[model samples]
Target: MTYTSLMFALFCLVLLLVYYVVPKKFQWIVLLIGSVAFYLCSGVKYILYVVITAFTTYITAMLAHKNKREFSEKLPQLKETLSADELHAAVKKNERKSRAFMLCAVAVDLGILIVLKYLDFVLSNINTFLPEGSALPLFSFVLPLGLSFYTFSAVGYVVDVNRGKYEPERNFAKFFLYLTYFPQIIQGPIPRFEQLAPQLFGEHKAEYKNLRNGYQLVLWGLFKKMVIADSVAAIVGAMLKNTSVLSGLELWLGMFVWGIQLYADFSGGIDVSRGVSQMFGITLDINFKRPYFALNLTDYWNRWHISLGNWLKDYFFYPVAFSKGYAKINKYTKKKFGKFFAKTVPVGILSLILFTIIGIWHGANWGEVLFGVFNGVVILISTLCEPLFVKIRKRLHMEERVFFRIFRSVRTFLIITIARVISLPSNIAIAGSMLLTMFGIRSSGTSFFAFTGQMVQAGDLKMYLPALFGCILLFVVSFLEEKGNSVRDMINAKPMFVRVAIASVGTVIIILFGAYGIGYVASNFIYSNY
Candidate 1:
């Protein structure tokens, strides 16, 4: 069930009531049932997919944990009975067995994801090179909801066990709960087993403060999604669908609006997820960190999707950058060129590779691949020119000024907005054409105001004022957050009458301004596709 729907709101309210009334010890069981029921609502067949992932990770991690325990018990016996070389060989053999188990688990988990998500994309591409009569038939497999997210979580869990990061869970139900937590399973911060497991299993009696804060955040998230994101989506949809009839100014406006739509939709979803979990007294990791305030592309990435950034750094970047192959390259470059070159080249290569993987993870399309590569290229170019930038800044003594920092942030935002086009359209060619039209180099001769007038006649004129008000609300909240102020806490600190007044006004705004109801078509959260 989508978080934005009225049905989902009623579901949460009922679940919260039952959750609190249950005996304290059975709260976790209540969650397990609720989670499974939630998935079943999507489709009975979909539950099978998540079960496969959860079961595979559970069995493999237990096996690895058992092997490690056995090996440790036998090590002392082997040391007493054998020479140093024999002991070393015995240990190596056991390590090989453990590694094989870990690899098999990872392959099965990721293999399922690959076949369901990318197999069709792969087959369609292969057919392009084949004779018409010899083309392969495409398979129509329905991808399970949040397949990428839960698969990655499971794979990371088993791998971490192999690396001796944490002991595996002995209880199967608890372990499965870690993988299937409903709020995060839909779109995630992709919690590590160690971080999320305890919270899932422990009892949490509903507290008044927790309830108040949780509902507050959920309402705030609704404001961002329904009032701002869905409202702007109408204009963005109209402009993008009729780019051939829009002026250069209108095209640029559409692009800017799309960026806002995407941010509101994705981050707003996360806020709702976190708020729901918070009601149960479980605190999920923070995913966004005031990304718009970042002064560089790297800084923006660090803030934008904090969980994914940390995931890549831990799983992909550090391993590839520090691998033996890169180690050799590092030494050779340092000896032949200079320290600066040695330090930058290896990291730059791995950073590019990481972005490519990130892009492909979004979808099985060439546009996403190019989108990833484009981001990598920009990041690498900036890194390579840092010396020149530093030299210019030093000469002008402009680096430390407040105005200069603001300019840097604006520059980075524009660069990211341009890069957003790759994934905005169905194909790369359309995105490229849109960019050309946006620059006034290739207009279709339609007046900008005429297209906007069409929007009015189509009953979308009512959305504009609400969109503007919502955007201003977003800016104010984001600015306060950027300055290290907690807007939620500030609200909570007000007088009782004031708090009620604020909540009443916010709810009224959403009821009147929201874009979903009987006549309006409710849209799925955008990141739900990923």
Candidate 2:
């Protein structure tokens, strides 16, 4: 269900009442039942897909864990009987078997994701080069909800077990709950098995602080999604639909608005998930960190989708960077060029690969692939030119002034906003043409604000003004947050009456300004599809 829907609100309310009312030990059971029920509501057929993924990974991890236990037990015996070299070989063989088990788990889960989500894209690409009318037909596979997210999480779990980082969970039920935790089963911060499973199974008493902070986060998320994001969605949708007829100024405006809409929708959904989990006295990782305020492309990445970046770094980038092949390349570069070039060049190239994979992780389309490549290329160039940039800064004798920081932040924001076009459109060519159109060409020499005025007129001032106000409020909150101030903490520290007054005002704002109800359809979070 969409997070903004009334059904979802009611569902959370019921879950909360039952959760705290039940015996503390039974809290986990309630969560499991609720998660299964929620997944069932999406589609019975699709539920099987996630179940199979969870089941396969769990069994494989258990087998790997069993082997690890056996090896540990036998190692002492082997030390007494075998020579040092022989013992080493035997241990290596055992480790190889463990890796094979991990690979099996990865293959099954990733294989399912590829077939369901990317088989059509692969077929179409092959069809482009085929003889006329001789192309293979594509499969009409229905993608399971959050297939990539859960698959990656499950794979990470099994890999961790193989690496002996953590033992495979012995209780099947708890493991299933970790895989299918309802709040994160849609878009995710992609929790690690060890980090999240214990919380899911642990017992906790109902706490006032948890409830208060949880609801506050939920309300704040609603304001962002409903008031700020949804308000801009209308204009963005219109501009995209009629790109051919849109003025250059309108096209640029759409891109800017889309950047806002996407951030709000994705981050807002994450906030709701965190809020709900917090009510149960669980905390998820923070996903966004005022990404628009980033001073460079690297900093932007570090802030935006923080969890995903961490996942890719740990699981993908680091592995490739330290792999034998990359090591060889590093040595060659160091010998041929110098130390500085070798140190950064291999990392830059590997980072590019990591980003391309990230892009493909987004969708089955070529546009998404290009989007990933674009980001990878930009980041790679920045890394390669770091020395030159450092020299330039030294020559200019630049100070770390607030105005300079703002300029850097604005520059980074615009770069990301433009890069976002590839992911926003169905076709890459159309997005490219729109970008070109936005540069200088305008229909009938219309001013930029004139097109903006037309959007305001179409939306009516009542709708338009609130959206503008919401953006302003969003900026203020983000600014405070970037400065490490917690508005929630500030509110919580107030007197009971003052806290109630603040809560009441927040409720009133949402009731009056939220873009939902009879005339509006709830939009799914943007990242849910991924």
Candidate 3:
């Protein structure tokens, strides 16, 4: 069921009731049952995919950890009986066994994800070059829900276990719970087993504060998804359809609105996920941190999609950047291109590669590829020019200025909006041409105010009004939070009547202005597909 659906509400209520009523030690079992129930609701046949992932990762991690343990127990004996070289070889042999397990698990998980999610794209591209009637038939495998999120998490766990970050979980049931925890299965913060497992298996009581904060957070997320994102989704769709007739400003405007919808919808879903988990006394990672307030691509990425970015940095980026192969490339760059490129270019190149993976990870499309490349290049150039930008800002005394800070934020947002166009539409070429067309365009001779009026007139203002107003409220709340004010805490500090009144009002507004009441269409959260 959808997060905002009545059925989901009842499901959660029933689970929560049983969750608190059950024995302290058995609470996790209750939660696992709930998770399985949620999984079954999506589709029963897809259960095999999860089973395979859990089995492979669990078996691999257990075996890898077992190898290490066995080696550890034999270490003293080897040291006493063997020569230095022989001892080194013995240790290396054990290490190889563990490494093999880690790689095999990673390959299996990634293989499943690649085949289910991207194999069709590969086959389609291949078919384009084949003899007309001899093209490979597409398998069209359905991706299990949360395949990308869970695979990353599972692989991360296996890699960590192999690296001795923590002991591999011995209990299959507990490890399975970590993977299928219902709240994050849809759109995850990609929990670490070391961090989330104990909390998952730990006993939880029905604390009043958790119940209050959680329910409030859920309501807030619904407000964003329903009132803001869903309301504006229609406008984004209409603008995409009419892009051929639209002026450059109109297309740019649509992209700007899309940036809002993207943030609201994705972050809104994360909020709900974290909120639900919070009620269980489990804290999911904070996935967003006022991303719009970021000053550059680096800062923007650091704030936006914090979980995945951190995951990539920890499990992907650093590993490649710190690899022996990269070290050799660095040495060669230092010799040929001087120290500056050695210091910066390698990282710039690495960042580009990392971000391109991120872009490709979003979807298996040429548009997404271009989107990643565009972002990667921007980051590369931005890194190379950072010193120049600093000099310019310092010379002009602009770095510390309030207006300049606003300018940078706005500039970064425009760049992000431009990148959105490359992927947000069905036709990437048209989108590319649309951006290029902006440079040489004759103005429509319409004032900005007139253009905005046209935007409102393009769709039902009733739909537009809520979205626009909600964005304003969102900005205000975010601004306050950025300034270190907790809006929820502020409300909680008020009298009981005040808190209830606020929650009631927020819930009623969501119901009335949400997709249910408005002409706006309710769709799945955008990131759920990924």
lDDT of each: 0.83, 0.85, 0.87
Number of clashing pairs, model 3?
Answer: 0
Q: Can you write out model 1's per-residue Cα lDDT over 1-530, one digit (the tens) per residue? A: 79888888888888888889999888888888888887788889987888888888888888888898899998889889999999889888888888788888888999999999899999999999999899999997888878888898898899899889999988888777788788887778788888888888888988988888877888888888988899878777776677676776777777788878888888888888988989988888988887777889888888876787788788778877778988999999999989998888778878898889888887899888887888888898899999999999999999889899999988887777777777778878888877787666666676533354433343377787888898898999999988889999999899999988998888888778888655866578888845
Q: What order do you get sorting by lDDT, best first?
A: 3, 2, 1
User: Can you list the residue pairs that collide in candidate 2?
Assistant: none
- In the predicted model 1, the residue pairs found to clash are none
Q: Give one digit per residue, the lDDT tens place, for model 3 in 41-89.
A: 8899987888899999999999999999999999999899999999999
Which is superior by TM-score, 1 or 3? 3
RMSD to the native, candidate 2? 1.8
Q: If scored against the real structure, what TM-score would every candidate get?
A: 0.96, 0.96, 0.96
What candidate 1 gets wrong by more than 4 Å, as runs, is 446-459
Over all chains combined, what TM-score does candidate 3 have? 0.96
What's the CA RMSD of model 1 in angstroms? 1.9
Candidate 3: where is the Cα deviation over 4 Å? 440-459, 518-522
Worst 10 residues of 2 by lDDT: 448-457
| Highest-scoring model, lDDT | 3
Q: How close is candidate 1 to the true structure, as a TM-score?
A: 0.96
